[model samples]
Target: MKKNTEKTVNIWDRLRQSDGQSAVPTDQPWPKIWQGAEGLGQDFEPDVEAGLKRLKAKIHAMPVAGARIRRLTPLARWTRTLAAAVVAGLLGWGIYLLVQPATPVATWAEITTQAGEQKAVVLPDGSKIALNSASSLTYRTDMNEAAERQVQLIGEAYFEVERRPAQPFKITTRQAEVEVLGTSFNVRARAEETTTEVEVTQGKVAVHHLIRDEKVVLAAKEAVLVANDQPLVQETSPHLNRQAWRTGRITFRETPLEAALPLLEHYYNVTITWQKSAAPACSITGNWQNDSLTEVLQAIAAYTGITVKQLTADTYQLSGICK
Candidate 1:
């Protein structure tokens, strides 16, 4: 054994002195390490494979880089916490995007008609409203909801309310409130007019004053006029002409010229002024369906034995000038 060790030492010394010029056999290097390992095994156990497995286990169980571990500073800890919070927030937002149907935005609708112009709108509940000249209707998009089928009206509108017992429709005007389950009626609450009128052509309606709280229930062919602070007064005249303007017709059954002229002006959105205070007293009785302004004026002149002349685009004058 001593002789073998001397021979190995001399070989290594030669290799070092020659700077690897004298090449050593590749297989000869591990023999020296193996000899050292074999000497260590003799002190432990006879089974090399079992001892090696135990050593590997011990190495794996030892703490890895224990001295390199460092505690976070206050600022660093906060940064870590904020990063976790940001991740959690992103996760929550992603979950929110997965469920629940998106809600559509609620919108308000408004319709305004100028003079000589009219408009018709079908409400969300399938109810119909015909707005007359110089009229406005305001409503919301989500109107079909219970107690939400409400509309605000100004000027004149003919309403054909749909029958919804659960959702009673209500019309609010500046002068009064008209509530109905189902009704076809005409509401005239013009700002210039002295009285607010409600005439039911079909069905029934409950009309109440806004500021006064006085309520009146009117059925088909019934009409009421609500004046400020006064009790509700039923109109003595017939309600047949209540829906005349809707059909582009003016029906006068023994209606006086002074009163009929206003209806004609309202229907055609025109103005008529007389020069004399003592004008010809004549009553008009006819049905002018969808007639032009000039045609209506000529027909009126023929019926009243007066002359009609256009003063302007929207104005007409009456006199005995035409033969």
Candidate 2:
């Protein structure tokens, strides 16, 4: 279903003709005159009176329109030679494409972590990435010249990118592009967080908003929160939480129940919510260790007095008293 343009056909023909009966060297060291006539599909006749006499009487009689066949001229013979070169190069490129296997489509690497498990990955370029619990990153294992480093992160990860001065590393999502050069950062793009969050622990990064055509640069200890219709880059405050799931723990400092629910689900792989009437106003203030799902839920219920209801393998319902 690929279209072979006239240009392509002509180039192939020239390559074939140039091969002729004699076995040409694989090196293809065509004369400069032949090299010059590349794309124009020009033909060449030898100079010198005797060569021209033979060309005019024989194989060179018919001239392909718009293509100059070298005539016995003291004038513009070089023009036709240049055209020949152009055609040869195009043919060579075509041959290369035909002989070579189709390039493989790029895809992301798959990474998964068990409930309490973590992993560290050293990328092809020597960059180090750590994946946290219940997290995964998809990226191309093969690095090519066309695209440097590109990966997609789901859940949370800590990246220690290797320094590649010429190639800029890029992390892409459904909404944004995070560009960096040899920096450490944590990215959390959870399905629960309403927004994709990127926090830089060291070095500098630029986050570009895909929809708004906006770009924000973050320094060390800075973070950007990107959500649908809302994108913000703010100086990280002291009250800010840890972004790395592997090393740092999540903390709730009198935060509302609704705000804390998403984090709990992400870490424990279980869903927890609140009864309608008590949900918005109920606040939670406590430090939860890396405890089991039941223990964490019990602590929350002890503070707010809301009953935790388990619905299925992965779903839960919160109801009853909050006051």
Candidate 3:
């Protein structure tokens, strides 16, 4: 061991003293030292020239000393591309959220009434609505001078809209759309019925059909009926009892019994079936208010000489002939 140590020290000393281009002295006992070192590992073989060539090539490829050359494989390149895309998407989404307009959330105020019930509501803009039985009125809570004042009605209602020429009041129904600057009107848009009726008692109103897209302008005391797939029919003299539900006043000026029966049924929410095959040429005329259904029926029976019988709770039968 001592001899081998001395030989290794001598080899290192000579390597340090020799210039890069100088060759080791052939006279030195180099073979004995190498042979002695090889005995320590019988399978060890040295390829000094090939190892030096590989190290030199690696150092030459580097941009600077001790700096590693990192080559990006296909998978690494794809990962980097995906990361950039994700970052770009995040930035784009952020920009979009910042620049996009905020959508306004609508706040609604609704009033509904059941059968044989009634309700009245005053809007924020001073418009009044009287909802009849089995009716509903829906409007936005934020209706003001700056916003559009629009209301949706189902069934029957009487509207006394305040005059706002700048922002016209609009009423939307199932079959018709009524727009007016200011008006007192009655709208009957019953769900069970396909036809919608709009009567303007005061001011002017523009009625438009939803299905046919036909339009008609109604003055005071004018009315229009909008039916599905039907032309716009404007009435110069609308029914007198159009607002009877709201006012509780019904007037029949020589109205035929056949026509008056339906009006009575509507006003009292009763069903009257005529038993006779042919209706008599009977006419009724009077103004009544705050009268019971029985009193009204009795009056009609006395005037037309028709027999009124209570068949059921809400169903009634009418028989006999006109006096």
Q: Which candidate achieves the best lDDT against the true structure? A: 3
Candidate 3 Cα errors over 4 Å, as ranges = 1-101
Instruction: Name the runs in model 2 displaced over 4 angstroms.
Output: 1-108, 113-118, 133-135, 144-147, 191-194, 228-235, 238-244, 307-317
lDDT of 2 by residue, 29-132 (tens): 45433545454655656569997788788866766689865557744677778889999999999999999999888755688887767898888888889888
Better of 1 and 2 by lDDT: 1
lDDT of 3 at 24: 66
Checking candidate 1 for backbone clashes, the offending pairs are none
User: Model 1: per-residue lDDT, tens digit, 150-222?
Assistant: 8888789999989988888888877788889998989888868766789988898899987788888898888
lDDT score at residue 128, model 1, on the 0-100 scale:
90
Candidate closer to the true structure by lDDT (higher is better), 2 or 3: 3
The model with the greatest TM-score is 3
| Number of clashes found in candidate 3 | 0
Rank order (by lDDT, best first): 3, 1, 2
Poorest stretch of ten by lDDT in candidate 3: 18-27
Models ranked on TM-score = 3, 1, 2
CA lDDT of each candidate?
Answer: 0.80, 0.74, 0.86
TM-score of each: 0.63, 0.60, 0.68
